[model samples]
Target: MNLLSAGLVAAVVVLIALSAVAIIRADRPGGAWGRRLRSRLLLGVPWGTIVSVLFVLAVYLFVQRGYWHWTDPVTIPFRSWSYLYPTGWLTSGFAHAGPGHLRGNLQATIVLAPIVEYAWGHLPQERGSQSFASWRTNPWLRAFVLFPAAVLGVGLLTSLFALGPVIGFSGVVFAFAGFALVHYPVATIVALLVSSVISTVVSSLVDPIVTATVSASPPSAPSWAGIAIQGHALGLFLGLVLGLAVLYRREGRPSAARVWLAALVFAVVQGLWAVYWFRGGGTYVLYRGVGVALVLLLALLVTLAAVASERPLISGERSLIDPLSPLQTALSLALIVGLALVAYLGLGPPFVGSASVAVVITVALRILYTVVVRIAGSGRWAFGGITRRHVAITAVLLGVALLAGPAVVPNLVTVGDDAVPEGETVTVEDYTIAYGEEVPNRMVSAIDISAFGETTQINTSGVIVINEDRHIWARQVSPQQLAYSGAVRLRLGGVGWSESVVVRREGWTAVGNGTAYQVWLDAEDTPTQHAFDSAPQTATPSIDGRTVTVVPDDGEFYLGVERGNESLGRTALPEVGETESVGRLLFSTERRDGRAVVVAERGGTSVAVARHEQYR
Candidate 1:
C-alpha cells in the first residue's frame, strides 16, 4: 500500500482498539452496563442476529451468484412473479437485485435485528419460566435454532403474499424494525440513525475518496418509486402481531405514545409513506399527502393494538371469555381480505377500489356490533366475551388486510397471452429477448386494470424479455435507460444455470427533429438480431433548396438529400471530419459549438443538417 494509505489504515485500527478497550473497562466485573446487557442478552451478544445476517449474505453471494457478478446478477427467475412459480416464492425473499441493494438491507439487519433478538432473549422470558427447563426455554436452542427458524418462516411468508415480481431482503428488514419498535420504541428510532451511520462508514471505507464534476446523469425515477409497499406492510404487521403476543405473555408493556411516535417517524423516514401508482411508459404518480395521512393512521392503530386495556368493551356478568371469539376474529380477517381481492379485480383504480372495500368492511363491522349488542341484551353470553384488546387486535388485522389484500389480485395473474412483441428476437431456450417501441406491457396488461384515466395496457418502449414457462414478462431496459446508457447487458438464470443478452442502440439526432435509431440484441448460442428500427428522420435545414435526411436501415445509416419527396441522391454517412457528395449536395461532418454535426453545402451556401447523439 502507499505510505499515506498505510498511515490512514493504521490510524483507524488504533482508534478502534482504543474504543474497544474503553468499552471493556466500563463494563468490568459487576458494572452497570454489563449487568443491564445480561438481563436482555446472552454474554451481551445477539447471536441470532449475527447468524441471520450471515445467512442472508450467503444467499446473495452463492445462490444469486453475486460473488462473480457483484453489480449484475441473474434476477429474472428469482422474482416472486406468480403463485405457480414456487422457486421464486421460495427464494425471492432472500435474493437481492444487486450489491448496493444487498448491502443496504444487511446494514439495517445488523443494526436493528439485535434489538429484537435481545428482547426475545436466549433466556426464557415468560413468567414463572426457567431457562433450560425444556427445548422451548433452552438458551442455546432459542438463540441458534428457534430465532433463525422464525426469521426464515417470516421471510417465506413475505414472499408468498408479496405483490408482483418483488425481490430483496427489505421486507424482512422492516419486520425487524417493527418487532424492535414494540419493546424499545425510542431505541428502534435511534438504531435507524445508527444504521445510516454504519452504511456511511462502510461506504467511506470502500471508496476512501471520490471525485466528481458537473455533468448530466442518466434519467431515473424517484428512489421510492419502486418500493414494495405491500410486502413491507405485510412484514411489519406480522412482526407487530408476534411482538404484541410475546409482550402480553411476558406481562410487559411499553408506553403507547412512544410506540406511536416511533412508528410514525420510522414509516416517514423509511419511505413507507410513499404511496404511488404506476402510470406506465416509465412514469408514476406519488400520493404524498395521502401517504403521510396513512402513516398517521397506521401509528395510531399499532399503538392501540399493542397497549389497549384488557377490560371488556361491553360490561359482562360472564366470568369466561367466548370460545368462538378467536375463531370469529380469524374468519373476519380472512373474509375481509377475500372481499378486498374481489373488489380490486372488479373495480377501477386500485386505491379507489381498496377504499370502496374499506367502506364495505366498516358496514360489516357495524352490523356485527349491532348483532353483539342484541345478543348481549338477551344475557345469554355477556358482550360475547369480547374485550377492548380483542377489538384493538381486530383493528390491527383489518389494517393489515387493507395493506396486503389488493396485492393478491396482481400476484394471481400470469402472462398467459403472447408476451413477445412481433419483431426480430433472439431466443435462448425458453427465453425470448426483443426490443420494440410503443408495445403493450404484458406484465401490466395480463389483467385489465384502470385508474385515473390510465389503464394497465399503456404502451412502453425498449428491451423486453419473456419466459412463459416461468411466468416472466419484464421490461429489462426502458427507453430512457437505454437512451442514456447506449447499451446494457442483462442475465437470466434459474437454479444453477445462466445466460446473457446484450442490447445496443445507435441513433443520430436531427438538427431540430426526432432521432432515427436501430436496436440489436445478442444472446448466447444465437445470432445477433436486428430487434427494432425507426423511420427516416428529416433534418429541419434547407441547403441550396435541398433538405438532408438520416435513414437507418439494417444496421447501417445513410444521408439522403431530398426536395419534396424527390430524392436527389443517397450516400453512406461519412465519418467525423470526412466529406461525401450526394448528387449536387456536399455533406461533411464537423465539430460545431461543442456538438458533432453534419453540414450540407452546395456552391458556398452551407447549413447544419444532423447532430450525432451522445450517451454517457
Candidate 2:
C-alpha cells in the first residue's frame, strides 16, 4: 500500500476501532467525537481536484502554446528535469496529459480522504457564551487552514524549475495525509501502511523486476513519471512544522517581534506570487499563481509560530516559553508525522511513496540543526560567525554529500575505427584535456550517443523523434585503435551521457546522427549495407585500412558486389523472392534455375540474387 491507501485503511480501522473499543468499555475523553465520524461525505468544492485539473491544463498550454512550445511530454523532460521550474513552477500540477497518471492520483485521493474531511468538518467548536454567534471551529481549524496551503506551496516552490512539468494530486493528497496525522493518528498510521504496500509496486518491486529482466535501469526518474520526492519531502516537512507550530502558538505565548518577522516573509512571498499571477495569461495560470500565495501565507504562519515560541534567531523574538520548549516541539512533530507515515504505509495505495530511509534521517538531522543552533546561542540572534549548531549542520550536510557518491561526468573514448568499450565509469570531473574535433552538438548539454553501423533496435523507440533537421547515419570505426582501446565505458550518475550498451565496430554497422540519439542493434542477421552511387575503382577498402573512405564517380553509378537490399525493411531476410527493383513491394521474383531470380516489374524486369539462406 502507498501512503494514501495506508491512510484510507487506517482511517476506516480507526473509525471502527475507536467504536469497537468504546462499545466494550466506558468512553474515554473525545469518545463521543469518534462515534460521530462517517465516511463518503464531500464538503467544500472538490477544491483540490479543481486545483489539480487547472495545473494540468496550464502545464499543457505552456508546453503546447508557451514560447518554448514543444508540447511533447517527453521533450519537456528531455531538456532536463531540473530546469522545469521557471517555465512552470506552478503550472506543473494542473494537467494529467494522459489518463493513467490522472486516474492513479484520483483513486488515492478519493479512497484515503474521507476521514480527514469528516474529522475536520465534525471537530467540536469553541463557543462565545452570549455576545456573538458561536463558530464551530475545532482545535484543528488552524491546522486545516494552514496545512494544505503549506504543502501545496512548499511542493510547488521546491519542484518549480525542475527538469520538466509534472502532473498529479499527490502533493495536495499528501497535505491531507499530513493533517490526518495530527487529528487521527491510528487511522492515519493504518492508511500509510496500506499506501506503503501499493507504493512498493512502483518503486521496489515493479521497477527493479523490469529493470533486471531487461538488464537495465534509467538514470534518474523519467520525465513523465510524476514522481516528486523533493516536493514530497518539502510537503512532509511543512506538515510536520505546521502541526507543532499551530499548537505551540495557541498553547504557548510568543513575543511580538517574532510574529513580525513571520509577517515580513509572508509579504515577500505574496509579492512574488502577485508578480507571477499577473504574468500568467489564463484563469488556470492565475489559479496556480494563487497557490503560491497560499504557500506564502502558510510560511508566514510557520514563521510567526517559530518566532513566538523560542527560535529567536529566525523571528528575532525573545521566547517567553523557551521557544516552545524542545519537548513540546518534538512531541508536536512526532505526533503528526508518526501517525501519518504509519497510515500512509498501511492503508494508502502504493502511489504514496516514501523517501529513502537515509533522507528521513536527514530530516531529523536538519531539525536537530535548527534546534542546536537556537539553544547554543545565548547572545543576540543569528549574527554569530560560527555557532556550534552551524558546525553540526555543516558536518551533517557535508557527510551526506560525501556519502551520496560522486556524480559521474561522461566523455567518449574511441578504441579504434568503431569500438568504444563497455562497463567502465568516468566522471566529467576527471577530464582536463581539450577536444580534438568539435564536440558533437548533442554533447554540449551532456547528451551522449556512441552510435554504430546498423539501424535495428534504434528505430523502435518513440523517444527518438524526428524534425526536418534530424538524420541518422552509420558510425564505423575499429575497436583496434590505441586511443579508445584503453578508454572506459559509462555509468549513470543519473544525468547526462553514458549508455547501457557500448558499441563495438566489429558488430553490425549501426547508425545514428553522431549525437542527441540512442542507437542499438535489433538483429545480428542483418547485412551491412555499404550503398554507393557508383562502382569502386577497385576494392578500395582493404582489411589493413583503418577507415574506408567512399567517393562517388562522375555519372558512373555502381555499387559494391551483389547483396540483398538492407535499407527499407525491418527484417534482415528478404521476403521470400522479393526484390527492391520496383518502387513498391508488389513485384515478386520468379526463380528460374537456382543462382538468382528474375524480378518482374510494372514496365520491365530486374534481377535479384537468390542467396542460399533466402531460398525457402
Candidate 3:
C-alpha cells in the first residue's frame, strides 16, 4: 500500500486499541489507568489557560483561511522600536504560522501549562491561611496573573532582538516545560516523552502526504517550519530562573540549591548546543537530538536529587552518608564524559569544546563560592542575611545568561564586512578580484567592489560570494536574508537578475528579463545548441571541440568551454576565464582590470579578438 493508506491503517489500529483499553478500565474501581487519567484531567488541566489557547488556535485557523490578516498585526517586527506596540507584543505569543505549528505548541501547552499552573496554584499561603479573599494570598490568582505575563513578557523580549518577525507560542510552551521540570518532574518527563513519540510518529506518517499536497495550498500562508530556537532558549532560561525563585520561596535553601545545580547542568548543555547550532552550524536534527538527551539527563539527575533530599525535608534528619560519594561522583563524571563524546561525534567538536569550557567555568565558580562560604562561616550571612548561597546562585545565573544571550547576537547582527581568506581570488595583470562582496546584507545592501580599476555596483539580498572568477553571485536565503517577500530585489550593473527559476508542469521557465540559457543533450544524444527558443534545449552528448565561446550583444562577453560541448545560446556575451586549446586553435577568455577579452588564435597567429565594457 501507499503511504497514506498505510498511515490510515496504522491510525485505525491505534485508535481501536486505545478504545478497547479505555473500555476495559472504564468501570473498574481503583483502576490505576482510570485514576491516572482522572488526575491529569482534574489536577493537570489549567482550564482558563487551555481555553484561551484553544480560542487563539481557532482565530489562527480563521486568519489562515483569509478571514483577516492576523500575522502582521500580531507578529513582532524585527525592529527595536516595534516593541513599543503592545498589540503585537502581547498577541504574538498566541499567533502561529500554520496548523502544524499550532498542533505542536498546542499539545505542549495542554500538557505542560496545566502542570505549571497546578504547581503555582497549590503553593501554601503564609500564616497557614489558604484563603482566596486577597489576591496576594491566592495561589490561583497569582498563577493566572504570573504565567501569562511571563509568556508575553519573555515572548516580547525575545522578539525585540529576533532575526526576523517572531510569532507562535513555542517560546511559551518551552517556558511551561521549564517550569514543569522543577515542580512536577515525573509527570513532565512522562508527558514530554509521550508527546515526543506521538509527534514523531505522526510527523513520519503525515509528512509524505503533506509534501505531496503542499502545492495545492496557497503559498501566502507562511511556513510552519524553522522554529525560533533562540526565543525558545531564552524562554527556557527564564522559566528555570522563575522556577528557582519559586522553589526557594516554598521549599528551602537546599531544594533551591539542588534545582539551581540541575538548571546549571541543563544550561551548560543548552549553551553547548547553542554554540553548535549558531557557531558550528549543526543540523536541526542533531540540535534536537542533543536537546532531548539533555532534557532526559536533567530529569534523571533532578529526580535522583529530589529523592536524596526528601528525607531531610520530611524528618529534618540529614543522611549520615555524604551526598557526593565517590561512586556517585564517578557516575556523574562518566555520564558527563559520555555526553561530551556523543556531542562531539553526533554534533561536532565545537559543541564538545564549548560544553567542556562551560563545565570548567561552572566548576571554578562553584569552588570560589564554596571558599567564600567557608570564609564567611556557615551560620553567618555575608551581608544582611544574604549568604554565599545567594551570591553563588546569582553567579550561576549570570553565567547562564551570558552563555544564552550571546547566541542570539549571531542571529541578529547578520550583516558585517568581515573579510575571509577562504574564498577563491583571481589576480589579473592589474588587479585582484573576487566574485561577490565580502560583507553580507542582512536584508538588502549594496555590493560595492573597487577591484580591477572599476567600481561594481549591485544590490545584494544576502552574503554574495564570487566563485571560480565567475560573476555568479550567490546568497543564503535565511530568515535574516528576507524579512518579507519582495523586500529585497537583486540587481547587477543596473540590470535586474532573477534570483530563482521556476519549473511548472508545462515547462521550465526562467523568471527574469535576461536571456535564459541552459546546456542539455539533444534527441540524438548529441551535445549542441540547435534551437535557442526550444522548451527543452538540445544538449550534445559529446564535445567535439576542446573549448567553446559565447559572444554577447550588449554586455561584456567571453566564455571558456573546456573538455565539453559548452553552449551559451543567449544573446548576451559570456564572461572571460582561463585559456585552453585541444588542437592548434587557441581559445581563451580572460578578464583584466574589470574588462573581459575573448581571443582566438590559429597556427600561432591571432585570428579574432573582442573587447567588451572598459574598466574605470
Candidate 4:
C-alpha cells in the first residue's frame, strides 16, 4: 500500500520470475505430458501439502477478520495439559499471530517442502534391495500423507515445552532442513545460509530505509519472536537423527559415520555456545572462560583436524590438490571464510564458532573422500558437480530474496478490534459482577462498606475469575463479610483473580490482589489455576516527605497525592505504562486484575504502608 510495501512487492515479483526461470531450466526434456504432470504434482510442487496449508491459512485469516482472537481456539497454550482442543496441536501450525508471521512461514514452506517431498518420495532403487510392496511403501503415499503427518507430529511435540502459545510452520521448515541435509547437504546448507542467515541480515539493513520512507517503526532485531525457537530446534534434531538413519541404510555405514561425525561436532559446538550465552555460570566460565576460551579451543581443534586429515600420503600424484581443481578449492575456501564472517558478525559468537568447525569438517570430508579413492584405486571421487555458475546464481538469488522479502510479505499493521461481548454480567449470590468488555469471561466487582473496622471504611473491587471456559467463577464480597477484613479471607473460585483492594481508614490502603490468572485444563480434564500476586504498596515519601499515590481502577490508574491530607488529589493517570514523577518522588503502577497497583518511591527508600480494611 505504501512505498516500502510497493518496493517489497516489486522485489517479490522479481524473485518469482527468477525462480520460474530456474525451475524451467532445471526441468528435463524427455518425458510425456502426463508423466511430467504427475512428477511435477508429486515431487516438484508438493501441491497437496501446499494447498492444504494455504487453505488453512485462508480460513484462519477469514476468522481473524471478524474475531481477532480467533487463534485462541487453535493456540497450543504453554504447559497446558488439557485435551479439550486436541485438534489445536495440528491447527496451531496453520494459525499465525499476524500477516507477517503467516507470510514468513508460508514462504519457507513453499521453498523447502517441495524439495524434501521430492527427496523422500522417490528413493533410488538398489540392485539387490528387498522392498515393502504395500500401500505404506508407495512413494505417493509417503510424499502426501507421511510428510504432512511428520510435520504435524513434530509441531505438536515441540509445542509441549514451548514457553508460550506455539503456532506457525517454522518447526516443519526446520525439519525440512534436517532432512535435506542428509540427501542434499550442499544445497541445504546454501539454502540455510541464504534463507535463514543472509535474509535476516538483509532485512535488518533495509529496515531503517523502509521505516524512514513509510513512517513505520524500525523492525525488531533478528531474534525469534512469538515463534518458538525450541520447537524449531527440536524438529531439526529429530530430522537429523532420522535422516542419518535413513542415509545410513542408503549410503553404507562408512559414509553415514562420516556425516554423523561432522554433524555431531557442529551440533555440540553450537549447543555449547548457546548454553554459554544463555545459562553460563561459574563452572562454564572456569571450563571455557565464558565464551572466548571455547571459541579459541574450537578453532584450534578444527584447524588441527583439517590439517591432519588433508595431509598428502604419497606426495606428487597423491596430493590433496590432485583430485580437486584449483577453482573448487578457492570457492570452498571463499565460502568458508564468507560464511564464518556472516555467522560471527550477523549471528553472534555461538554460530561463528560453529561455522568455523563446519568449515573444517567440510574440508576434511573432501580429503577423506580423496584418500578413500586413492586406497581403493578404482572409483572416481564424487564432488557433486558444484560450479562457479551455480554459486553465482545462488548468491544472486539470496541477495534478491533478502532485499525484497519484507516488502512482499504482510506484517502486524494494526491491533485487532476487541471481540469480547459488552455488558456481560453474572450474579454471585446477591451481588452482581461485571465481566470485562474486552476480555470475555473476566469478572470485576466492587463493594463499599460503611464500617469495616473500629474506625475504618473500605472499597474493594477487582477481577474475581478469568478463564477460557463457559462458566465463570469469582469471589463475591458480600455486605456481611466487610466486618471480617483480615480475619476471613474469601478464596475466589475458578482461576486468574486480578488484584482486589481493601481500602481501610480512608488514607491507609491495603492493596492485595491477584495478578493475571488463567486456568489451564490438563489432558486429564483437570483444571489448574495459575495466578501471581500484585506488589504490596504504592506511595513513597520524597526528600520533602511528599508522596504521590497511583491507585488501580478498572484497567486505569488514579493518580493522587498524600500530602497534608488535602482530600488526596486524584486524577486519571496517562494510559502509557511509564513511571511518572512529581518533584523527587516517583510513582509507577502495574496491572492487577482490571485495576492497578500504585508503586511510589522517593530517594530510593521504601515506605511502609497499611493494608486497606472494609468496615461493616
How close is each model in CA RMSD to the real structure?
5.0, 19.6, 15.4, 18.9
- Estimate TM-scores for all models: 0.89, 0.35, 0.48, 0.43
Q: Which stretches of model 2 miss by more than 4 angstroms?
A: 1-87, 111-152, 161-167, 192-228, 247-576, 579-616
Residues 1-616, candidate 4: write the lDDT tens digits: 6677667767866776898788767774335643654553454456546654765476454533313433232221212222233433435555555555665666566656665665555332333432346665655665566666766665665443332235666666666766665566445545544456535634543452443354433222123222343455555544543443344334232233334444444334334333211111101112234334443443333222222222233445433434446357546644754464343334432344435534543454345434433332224343323322223222322222222121111110111123222333333332223322113212211111111121101122333332334222232232223223322222212121211112111122433321221111111122322221223234444335555554554333355566565534555443336666554555555554544444556667644222223232
Write down the worst ten-residue block by lDDT for model 4.
406-415
**For every model in order, what is the number of clashing pairs?**
0, 87, 14, 25
Please, what are the lDDT tens digits per residue for candidate 1 over residues 1-616? 5666667666766877898899888778458876877776777778888889889888887788887777888788899988878888899999999988999999999888888998888887667889889998888888899999989988997897787789988888888888888889999999999999888777756655566999998888888897888788888887876676566555657899999999999998888888888887678988989889888988988888778666777676764655455346445545665565555555645555455455555554444434443422323222356677657655665555666656655676677566788789988878888887888777777767765575667787778888888888888788888889889998987777777889998898988999988899988777888888789999987876788889998888899888877988899888888999987898888987777888888998888888887888
Q: Tens digits of per-residue lDDT for model 2 on 1-616?
A: 5666666556655766787787657754335534443211123233333443345445444443322322223222212122312323343443333444544555455544553554433333213322113332422332344324543564564344222224444555555554444444456545555555555543432233222344322222223232453344343334434333233323333343443343334234223233211111111113345546545554444333333323233333343334345455445444444344333333232212222323343456447545544443333222243333233233333222222211111111111121112212122222211111111222112332221221112211011111111111112121222122322122111123212212221111111101011112211233322111212222222221211111233222212231133222211222345643322322343545553232223334332322111111
**Candidate 1 — what's its lDDT?**
0.79
Q: Global lDDT of each model? A: 0.79, 0.33, 0.42, 0.40
Which ten residues in a row are the worst by lDDT in model 3? 497-506
- Model 1: residues >4 Å from true position, as ranges? 1-6, 316-384, 452-454, 524-526, 591-596
Return the TM-score for candidate 3, rounded to 2 decimals. Answer: 0.48
Candidate 4: how large is its RMSD? 18.9
lDDT at 28, model 1:
80
Q: What is the lDDT of residue 573 in candidate 2?
A: 20
Give the top-scoring candidate (lDDT): 1
